[model samples]
Target: MAIMLSGHVIGLLKEYMQDLVEQARQETSAQERFGFAATVYRPDHAISDLLALLDDRIESEGMQVGLPEGFLHEIWSLCNQASVHVADRVYVESNVGSEAGSKARTRELTYRALLAFIEARGRASAQGEQGVMES
Candidate 1:
């Protein structure tokens, strides 16, 4: 029997157990058959522009912190690209296994990109919160 976890909990667990999860991902399947005791539940055929999501989030925060218009413009210009963003990669990876899919290698790259964004966002948000607390 399998038990499902909420996305928020899984994200938190993934963030916390990243190294352990990476080790699991790297382990060979010869003897015990490499497998996960747990995994993040990703959905299917998702298409979203997280640039918009992030922009909305930033603007919402700005309501309190007051970000500059130019800063928002620059951020938009950076993320508003033709290529797939980290969020898109993560979405695709979630639907497709990390190492098994149509474009497995490409998906892996996308997953990495998404992970990078996750780490960066974590750091940025933490700093933002700290600043709020300090001020």
Candidate 2:
């Protein structure tokens, strides 16, 4: 069975993902400014970053924010399920630029892939609901 997330939960997730993406951008910019070597980044790293964020949020403000119980686990499972799809999307985008900003680009691509997965799931769930209602 698939875990369904409500609009509120999805909204919160988007916010969290944006925060991570922005943090990556800042980190990349700082590294470039400081002449630090760019570290190799990939979709798996982005997924781990998101899962870490979710874990922290669930521990810190899960109840206050009205996150459903098992939310973190559910998201973890979803990430695993979507991993290949996300990685493919990220890989298709040519990584042919300065390595300094590659981390930020990877993060953005990963976030977008995850967002697309969530959106597709939401639509499918909605359509299923509609079908049931019509039945």
Candidate 3:
């Protein structure tokens, strides 16, 4: 049977994440955070690194996501990316005016592409997991 996170669970998850981030925010110091961001990993590397950080944080914090006996990164990617995609399906918050049509449409398209990419990753991860389980 497939388990699902109820709205309450998601809310608590978000709150829990925010609390963790709040602690990090307090600890890092503003200059350190800026210096780190200004000269840190590239976008793709940052994406994977952030995902890994989140995985570690969730595990360390003992937040039970109720996933099956498999990799947490796979589960986290699906959940987080789906939430991002749904939130951006109408308009992306970060989209600025571009040469496409309008800032709004471009932002929507940009996030649509991101959603597709994340979904593709999820599919590939699932296939690989299936293969591993069968082996």
Candidate 4:
């Protein structure tokens, strides 16, 4: 069964994702201005960053934020499950588009893919429950 997350958890995830995206944007801007790129950044890097942020948040203010118990483990599992798919989508999006891609774009695409995966998972889980109820 797909794991269910509260709206608050998703909200926090989105906020963290945006933070990473903005960081990528700043890094990309610096690289452009300085003519030197930092270490290669990829979707997996972004995922790991999100996981790290989640870990810190859980450790710091999980109860205050109403994050359920095991939220970190659940999100880690979800990220592991979605990682390949998110990476693939980000790759296709960054490469297939006519627009030039930057670190920020890559992060945005990765986050979008991950969010889409989670939403789809939630929908599938809800549908499965409904089917069981009807059976």
Candidate 5:
């Protein structure tokens, strides 16, 4: 059962990562042709708040007391990687100022990545709960 759970979690994480990469590529391509300004999206909420929500959901389901520390670390690491990728994309493709553009791109990518990760995790947890209920 633990192995199955682990496999499910890893699959979800991989899908989340692939989605982030696709998003980054699309954003980079858009910025390359036409200079685009960063706009605040609904999913650009605080990471802490998202994590708190996840914690609540996890507790309510009685599946686990807390998210695994390794999962948390991997999420953070992915966010950082996404941020760096955005920064590099903006710097290399955009004609904007170096420091400012890079900073803005980094911020945008970080928030987007966080939002994507949280949404994916939420969906996965919900599915898991549904499975438990059905069983």
Candidate 6:
């Protein structure tokens, strides 16, 4: 059975994914600015620590950070339900008789859906910010 994801769920997923992408972008930008050092005093240090700090700042206000285990569990459970629902509604079984092919198709569909969601959310966020600036 194929799962059908609603417009709202897709939208939410896209928004969430976009936020993650933007966060990664910002982290990269920050790293470019602050990652290098004049001296190799601490070459053993990981860039991940710096990235984590940047991520923390990015999500400091009006955003969630380091969600508790219980909250994460709940969110995962909900996401699983949503995925199942969507898969059942939209996924079509391949007649090629190849399990790998079916799995690949499903993965492709999932990735495309995620990308669409991210693009939509990024555009909406940009528009909202632009509106705020114009006001």
Q: Higher-TM-score candidate among 2 and 5?
A: 2
Kindly list the per-residue Cα lDDT of model 3 for residues 1-135, writing each as its tens digit: 223334554454445444544543454466466674323212233234335555675576534654234445454555455555544543443334343333223323433444455556646767887999999
User: How many clashing residue pairs appear in each of the predictions shown?
Assistant: 1, 0, 0, 0, 0, 12
lDDT of 5 by residue, 56-123 (tens): 54456424543454555555454454444444444454445444443334434444555455456557
lDDT string for model 6 (10-112, tens) is 4544455445445544654666598743322111121222234334544562134333324333333433444544344334433333553322244334434
The alpha-carbon RMSD values of the candidates against the true structure, listed in the order shown, are 14.5, 2.3, 10.1, 1.6, 12.6, 16.3
The TM-score obtained by model 5 is: 0.31
lDDT of candidates 1 onward, in order = 0.43, 0.87, 0.46, 0.86, 0.48, 0.41
Per-residue alpha-carbon lDDT of candidate 1 for residues 11-80, written as tens digits (9 for 90 to 100): 5323433433343345423323644333332312111223343456556664454344454454344333
Stretches of candidate 6 above 4 Å error? 1-101
TM-score of each: 0.31, 0.87, 0.35, 0.90, 0.31, 0.31
**How accurate locally is residue 40 in candidate 2, as Cα lDDT from 0 to 100?**
88
lDDT of 3: 0.46
Q: Report the Cα lDDT for residue 6, model 3.
A: 43
Model 3: clashing residue pairs? none
Task: Report the poorest 10 consecutive residues by lDDT, candidate 2.
Answer: 92-101
Which candidate comes out best when scored by TM-score? 4
- Give the lDDT of residue 4 in candidate 2: 83
Residue 41 local lDDT, model 5? 30
The better-scoring model by TM-score among 3 and 6 is 3
Point out where model 3 deviates above 4 Å. Answer: 20-29, 32-50, 61-74, 77-91, 96-135
